[model samples]
Target: MVCCSLENNDVGWFSRRQSAYQCTTPITASQSCGGLLARIRPTILQIPPIHAPSFMALRRDTLVEAVEFPIHLESIERYFTMTDRRECAFCASEITEINDSKEHVIPNSIGGRKKVRGFICITCNSSFGQSWDAKLAEQLNWFSLAVGIEREQGSCPAKIVHTVDGTELRLRADGTMTRKEPFFQKTESDGKVNIRMLASTKREAQQRLKGIKKEHPGFDLEGELKNLERTAFKVNSALQHRLELGGSEAGRSVVKTAIAQCVRLGIAAHRCEIGIYTLKTPTDDRGFALFYIRDVVIDRPQTDLFHLVSIRGDSEKGTLLAYVEYFGAMRVMVNLSSKFEGDSFISVYAFNPQSREELNLSVNWDIPATELHAAFNGFGLDANNFYLACRNATAIAYHMQKMRERHHVHREELSAVLSQLGIPPGGIPEPKDRDQFNSLMEEKLGSLSEFIKKIPPMPDD
Candidate 1:
């Protein structure tokens, strides 16, 4: 039997020979040996294919192919060729027809060519246009290309190292040195002993050593650490500081102030009212003075009608009189008396003749003595005789009550009128409360009712 051995040229020949020659056989000079030699020679002589081409060759080939190759122009050249064409990049529909504008994949202003290979239709472009930028688009394309290259060939073991400035250093993929200053620098009075660390890479480590020699003019080589703790600490500290202070409360306070000032200036009136009074509850021995304000009203205009200014007196003596006024030439004076601690009573009569008589005429129904007392206690009604203080401590309260009742009935009617249309309800909390409910309201609706109201409806064509 004839025997032959073949080995890979790329791998060390010795290692392949050792692994291949486990069994030994005698070689004979004969016709069979010639046949075996012929078969083995062909197998050993054939050159292995080169998987990775040199950079220079690749660049040369790309340029030559790009120039020599005949590019098949797409059928929709009219849409893609013109940089300023107002047609949709995707569908080739006229921008005016679609009521939109053509968008560039790479924005023209940023050194990006006007004509882009990838063009999206107006609808698709508009959706992307809302939030995308050229930098992001470029980064996405670069990442995709990198992934493709990595998949074609397994990852290469190439590394770079460098000693950047005392603060930070980046070793690029190709042998290059990048130095970044420390965000914060700490120093001692005793001469500046600059501290720097080097990344472990062949290209950068050699370059960094040379740089250190150049910088120091003549410095001895220092031992390297397996872990760069000082450099890592500095970097981590810088990152922490950036994360903490960047766009933090200090940064957002200015925005908050601007919004608050804008709301205060833009809104027509101060939609708020304050009431101060003394209450004599049965549980308490003496009446205590209290201060309270009505809930904030966003839309309603403030009216001074039957608004109480102040209350002063003892609850037991019934000497408490509330000084109050109404919007139009109306004033009231009320005397409150409590027979029992729990049960208080008040007699509401106009201070003047015309007002009292008008109020008496207006209130035809027999007023409950306790209710009148509670009304005076809760809201100063006798401040103006003609106007008996009505529901809640709001002038709009009467209108609001009527509106609320009508709201239920008008809900269906208004709903029918507003079907498919987004008219927000009239009631929304004032701007002061908006911050509290911003997340809730923003989740349910695109914006708060108050904010939506500020934006005028689109004009009918």
Candidate 2:
């Protein structure tokens, strides 16, 4: 266990047991939390008093991920007295301010918000993003969109889905779909030209018309615009989506995330020798990632759709293992290193991908080191557990779909109320009539209690 308390010095200092470690030196107050935290040792550093939430959390929980806390400091001694943590984990090059960058344990595109700095240099970080993280994001973006996950960076990539009748559609991040291509038909009979064009949107139709006008120079653009009609069709056909996981690219990414979590848990990245080697050398072998369902079960809180990561180190067994799960459907166990000779440690992080909110939870699996290795090597695989996980994922998706439908219905009802009040679709009432508008809206929309009862409360934090 680690414990730290603040000192009354000009610069904040923390003492761990018998030893004292200077976590921060006097620096400019204007520096951001990320920039300030990056200058410290990569090891676990207690958050300052100012960040009460994180500081209090740290006192009660030892396994929580480190939170950023800004402190006033000048450019004094930045290196930790224990070890120089500025060395890159992959390349072992000295990390300078110019080369340092924050690396997310989970890819940001897939709704990961936690990040660590000074663990890997910018070069290795960029390379991993382009290769490992990119492939993983591509493989998981469909589920991300379906879950309506909140991303730390750009929005999740849209997926190309197909209907049962073989119609191609672009599935957007918000659970909406549009035709991949515009539909156009032209007919000329009895010296009269007839043209029919249909598209998912008016803009799409107009763009297609531009191309058509080139072929038919005598076409009337104004008449066509006046005749344009907006159509909404309900698609009853089921959607078909394909997901393939555990490729070399995605395998590397899983391993990378495991190693990153280990680093965040106070294990130096250099100590993760096997993980570094596996990431650096690319191969077609998918054994690095194995579907894992805990043989020893413990009841965990129900989380609809969450991303989970856990790392365990057993010095006696001389093994370090990590587990990564995306959307609670695909679970993977990775053997990080077999030469681990550090103290036994375990850390878990579980959060709802949709809200990007961390959950107060823990995960436990009682598989022995030998059995885990055997499983990783393709021995004694459990097909039943994998199937169960997939089924559960499908159920969660269906639940989310139903919730979205309810919200859509609510929006339509609200729109109807606005129309009744002589308000435009997106316009609000004037300031003078605001009170009346509120009263009318409440009277028409019914009680808020009914809506709350219809939508279940989220899982406990």
Candidate 3:
């Protein structure tokens, strides 16, 4: 009689002896070992047949291979070692040193500085970065440029916009605009041709004049170039900006961030069934992601532009959810999974998009899993809540815009103050004059604070 003591909860593995095989009663299938067996079926099939007492005998008549107990245990141990290797949460590819890459829980492109390891392989990271993440970043670049969002990798991206008057503008990161192409308007007044040239740079203006030189051989291109005056042009008219928020590509990107947040919280990507499914399939307007439904208040300062992500798991209700707000402008909720079997947890991350400064944030959503499902399907009063949230977000964004304008004005005022202190505008004082400069700055800098009080109220206010 070979006595094999293989009693365990998840998997049963027999101990090895040098001389003979000792076999005890096999672990019962009622202890969840059956599920373990199913998972390791491929490994089990690779074992060579040995004429001995069955180690996994569910019945007394079931006689199977267990001739070499030590060899069998080694094989099971090797299989488990391979199975325990880290894999990408999205693609399930093994994460080796060659393939391991830091994944930002929020995308670095959109001012997301938080990063985690062992959650994704480099290949999947690159693929998502090019597809969904790229699109989402492009969609939010306008707001990023406006708010001067701090990024871990690079500066905010510039975007091309077409004004209502058919002027193509390249919006810069510092809230400045330039024409996409060198443009000149020709107007005739009182028998004289007045050419108005608007070029992005002096080089461009010179190039434009060179082209005009070909039109008239006698024209003094060099002379007119020397007389070129530089002036600032501001668009006073209303410029329409249309921001289309959600679709397949952008939706997948949002879900990716949500999944990364879950992975950061020690939840495996495979457990996020809905999130993975959404990433795999093509999504439409009614996808797994939706505009945030539950009532939420923007308690942060109105002038602060923030990017926020919140993840929560309800073990009793078997629901896992993620909430994301981009630049306090667009908000989305992702139903990560409905079969979550983890302990209840809530995690939040918030940061000023401009400063990349982390904020201590608390987020709570008492809404049930059923309501979340219904919210995704556009049921009940979710539409009302969504509208209200959007309105509030817009109000905050508008306030931020006004504040940004005031900030620019304050810079000019500071320059004037510097000139009054016998220092050239934008010039640093000499080392010898530093003592006097410091005293003057302290005396006059308080006036700069007055600009904040003059900022206009929000549009809704």
Candidate 4:
């Protein structure tokens, strides 16, 4: 028989047995326990307790994808090492330590969150903190691009008509004239006047009246009537020509088609004026198409002014389209408001959704800088001065760095450099009085450096 006992010390309890088979050595509790266990049937061996398997692996897989903050060990490590305690991503000022908080590479308001990765910095995060739902960067980019394209194209062609009682005149070819008369009537009144007037052209009638005027200085009645007829004829002719050129069916059709395309692309149309008898229809996406018809005949004279029309359209689908209705009749003119006169061409910007930002991607057709400067003058800002200052800043920075290595410092030389940059003699601020300017330059450089650091290392490929 085997006995089993529990013990608290190093020496185990021993069984009280002395025989040829019994050993005299102290039997450890383990040994006693083993003997007892051995006495049990071999088929019924004792077994150790079992524990439940860990679910940590499954939990990690389930949570990593959905959690916005650092969820996995690798990400957490990266957060601490790369972004946690960085400076403001945009402004580049050190504020917190790395690992203090997760910086959003993209701001949350613009559909960016911690899960998206590598878009936000601490300062930018705070600046845009909780201010989500601002216009998406993509939309801004699109708008900027659209505005630029339109500005470059100048104003779209429009058909305008102005009509006066018993007369209609149209201005065409920038300035041309055509005359059409429905009827001509001469009535004789038996007053104290006994004079017959007949001439081949209106100019001949005027010449005849001028001779009569010299003989009878006070005989202004015939001259006044002749002047009236000439004026009416000229006005009528001008109006007819304009209508023939601008208010034609073909012109209307071209405009209609262009407008339809703009509408489909989600662009807005402003001040669109088609010729009379033009056909127009709405676009599926939300715009209009116009068709010019020249079938209508107008005996009366009229004049028209096709003013600027503002167009808005969808950029993603390329909605806006422009074509010459009458190639010769259409002329694009950019109005120079006093402020923007010198700016011959304005910059257009487009919003990029992928970059989540706006970029000035293109310029209107090349315009002279002088024109743009004149344009800006209307705005009460000294554009020339501003331009010179900007140019000087760049020149100064470049030359200062170039001369630094040579250890040459000359105010006169610097002033000459400023002049080359278009700055007047006294435009540049003195170095001793330029603390703010220096700080601004340093801040800009710092931001650029920080931005470079945030860029991911290039891949081998």
RMSD of each: 41.9, 20.2, 25.5, 44.9
Cα lDDT of model 1 overall?
Answer: 0.24
Any idea what lDDT model 2 has?
A: 0.56
State the lDDT of candidate 4 residue by residue for 41-118, as single tens digits.
111222232232222213433433333421111100000123233333234445445522353222222222222122
Residue lDDT tens for model 2, 1-461: 01111111111111111222322222111111211111111122233333222211222222222322121011111011125466787789988888976788888878888887667889888876458788888877767776777676567776776654565776556554456765567789999777766575556767776777788889877666544542223344434445555667777888878877776766677666667777777763432655543522245444477788877666566666777888765677776666666567667788887777897666665664344444454432344444335434644653464365345435655664666567889888889778877886676355322433333233232
Ranking by TM-score: 2, 3, 1, 4
Number of the top-ranking candidate, with lDDT as the measure: 2
lDDT of every predicted structure (CA atoms): 0.24, 0.56, 0.56, 0.25
Clashes of each: 6, 6, 7, 66
Question: Candidate 4 overall Cα lDDT vs. reference?
Answer: 0.25
Model 4 misplaced regions, further than 4 Å: 1-193, 196-204, 209-306, 309-315, 321-461
Please give the range of 10 consecutive residues that has the lowest summed lDDT in model 3. Answer: 71-80
Expressed as tens digits, the lDDT of each residue in 298-392 for candidate 1 is 22223312211222233343233332222212222223222112112222222111111123212121223333333223322222121111111
Model 2 spans with C-alpha error above 4 angstroms: 1-82, 188-195, 202-238, 284-287, 293-297, 301-303, 405-425, 429-461
For candidate 2, the TM-score is 0.67
Q: What would the TM-scores of all predictions be?
A: 0.16, 0.67, 0.63, 0.15
TM-score of 1: 0.16
Across 366-405, the per-residue lDDT of candidate 3 in tens digits comes to 6543444443644322333333344345445534544664
